[model samples]
Target: MQFDLNRITRKNIQLLKPYSSARDEFSGEAKVFLDANENSLGSPLTKWYNRYPDPHHVQLRNKIAAIKGIAPEHIFLGNGSDECIDVLFRCFCEPGVSNTIICPPTYGMYQVSANINNVAIQEAPLLPDYQLNLAHIEQLVNADSRIIWLCSPNNPTGNLMNLEDIETVLNNFFGLVVVDEAYINFARQRSLISLLPDYPNLVVLQTLSKAWGLAGLRIGMAFAGMAIVEIMNKVKPPYNISEPAQELALKALDEVGQVNDMITLLVDMREALAAVFRQMPWVEVVYPSDANFLLVKMQQAHLVYEFLLDKGIVVRDRSRVELCDNCLRITIGTEQENTLLVDALAAWHEQ
Candidate 1:
């Protein structure tokens, strides 16, 4: 498909002049700094923090580029994936005029971000089997449809959307196709990042929050064509990523081997937990998962959720969510923690 970013982008954003920061103005090595109005005296906690973080995340993006096998120019850093979602809406969806499509029983943030940006939403609910409804999606696309959000190893469903289905949308859609891969680290499927050369409209979002265990750092990444990356950079705040966050992420990225080991362990625990649940008479179904969590349909699932809560164990009650009736979403915890959960569930089963 010929994806004309200019055709889809909001007019104001296309013509907008981005804010120039003190850091953006200077690039050479400098011993003395007078520009950003930092105190001559250093900060109380850390001397380095007195100065502003890099407005562009140059160093961090380079590090991530090396890891993801992409050029630094293709990456856009955000405070979190939430920020990326909101920025996409601002850049592409003109408020009230432009609309985006989302498959139901997917991530809640996509709809939340769209609503916050005053962008109309069109629903294309997932099929009964938890895959994209391509025909329904195609029907919903109109001239104003600027984005279609897909979640892989999807949030509540915990299964990757079929690769063929995703490519069909990318092949057909004229506007941007955003594939949020928050749980990609756990999935066996290859990320859509490699397809950037083929699809200019494809925007792949990943995060340090999941496998890297850096949720508190609030770092999210959006990989897209240079055009989309440039627009996202223009819309984001000057210092969307803090100096500490950048530093911590840099350190974490160096430990890929360790993270991979943890991922293996989590996957093991997830399967073990699922096996135990499968044997339980109370568990109606233990949905297949490519993510860190499991979506389980059980007898009186809400009561089971309450029972676990009363014992100080918490799991998501997704019974109210579409296609997940009488279901609970459970994240795979450490071995000991998983044992505690199983013990609690066994007790509930006995009751």
Candidate 2:
């Protein structure tokens, strides 16, 4: 399918001007702010809370640009990656007129987001090996299919899709290829962020939530061509990220050594947990992972899930998803947490 990038961005969006706050006009140092209406007395919540945040989040984007080797112009920050996902639909896709394609047994939100936007979701379920079905996906795309959501080191399966297969989709598809790399920091493959220059429709979404252990901070990032990102920026509410989140993320970026150390630790723990799962008598298989979690297949997923829940060891039962039978998506916790999980499984099996 062929598409001219300019022609496909929603008509209303192309003509519409984004709301401009007074702070947006002059970005340099400012004092005696009277721009946007705000409490003259600083809010008790936080001194920074009294004022509106940088509607564009310029400083945060630059820090991310340096780390990712992408330009600040290409970066977009959202309340979470989910916001970025949701906005893409609103920006380019016309509800009931446009559609999207997603792989099943992947992130549920991709499907959920599409549904919420009234964008019909078409599926080209991943092959039985849990890898992308490129041929099938090609068949699914048409003029109305506006985006394709691909999760690398896919959510419940815990496996990275072949990069070449993804490039195939990019080469052929006219619409945006949204790669949700929420877990890419844990993967060995180089990010497709570098491919942004190559594919105008490509958008790479990452978050500090996963690898940096800042899920609570709710900082999600999307990197793409400036044109596509501009549409998203237009739709996103101003002051999306709080000042505290910006402050903490700035601090976290400085603590790269600590974050890298933690990744190493989690990788070690992940492997240890994989080995333990392999030794369990009821365990059928432990899928290989490039993320912080394991997908373990066992004999009785229901009983095992219930047992773990009883013991206060929470894990996802993803057996209902296609190609993932009797599988439990287990996040690698601390040493003590993993030990308790292992012991719980051991005791459950003894009964």
Candidate 3:
């Protein structure tokens, strides 16, 4: 309940004086720029890209803040949500000494990032129904554990973690509780971003890669208390987001109606796909999903995966992931793509 950021953050990070760009000092309109040693001549490319991108992501964050109803100061735009995850480990977890909690059959990056940072990972796997095992999670929380990772509308599983269970962790654990909401735009539930003011230790991760259809642009957002956001900003590389990415993201944000319509179409297609999978004899289970994908258990998952691959249709083989045995994670593709997938499966069935 009482989250003291000073106590939790790494000592070296606490004292660290972040790299400040020339842009950090002056914030206003300037006719001619001579500050950061950009070529006075424009770039060879048609667009002006000779000057460095804004390190602070001022315009982009302000646009996001207006939409999310949060202050720009509380937002940190990373190269991807993966960057935000990595920065948290660097800023909080002391290598080898500090540890973090990860509920596996969840996102893979949390484990990968922890290993890269040399932070110990404690696994508190999801329960039988693919929900949080809160008691086990609470019991795993020790003094050395610095973060707990939760993925809602979880990857591979395609279900949202219960909000009450999340609140329980936030209340009991003094350390960081990162809720990855990468697929939140497709979910029915409201985002925990609205509760950032209530929980200081909470960090909500989101991305443009999913419903926004901007994976190539690679813009991810971390919404947290200003204290956490400031530290993340401090640790990140200057110009983490490219000028083209920012420009495109701003343009995408203005087309919320288009994004929403796309999401509605995907959700409908997801349901339709699930119905088709259910009718197939090989599909043992089609798990309930609130995201843009479905996790279906196949009778012979590897064979099915190989079959799909040979047809030049790609879907994730998540059969090896925990609690997702014999599963294929299928994204809700466009109408034609989905038809191709079903037709391929039907062809497999005929043989």
Best by lDDT: 1
Residues 194-293, candidate 1: write the lDDT tens digits.
9999999899999998988899999999999998999989999889999999888999999999999999999999999999999999899999999999
What is the TM-score of candidate 2? 0.97
Alpha-carbon runs more than 4 Å astray in model 3? none
How high is the CA lDDT of each candidate model?
Answer: 0.94, 0.89, 0.93
Which of the predicted structures, 1 or 2, would earn the higher TM-score when compared with the native? 1
**Which candidate, 1 or 3, would have the higher TM-score against the true structure?**
1
Ranking by lDDT: 1, 3, 2
The TM-score that candidate 1 achieves is 0.98
Clashes of each: 1, 0, 0
Evaluate residue 285 in candidate 3 and report its C-alpha lDDT on the 0 to 100 scale: 96
lDDT of candidate model 3 versus the reference: 0.93
Clashing residue pairs in candidate 1 are 153-160
Regions of model 1 farther than 4 Å from truth? 46-48
For model 3, residues 258-297, the per-residue Cα lDDT tens digits are 9999999999999999999999998899999989999999
With a 3 Å backbone cut-off (N, CA, C), the pairs that clash in candidate 3 are none
Indicate the TM-score of model 3: 0.98
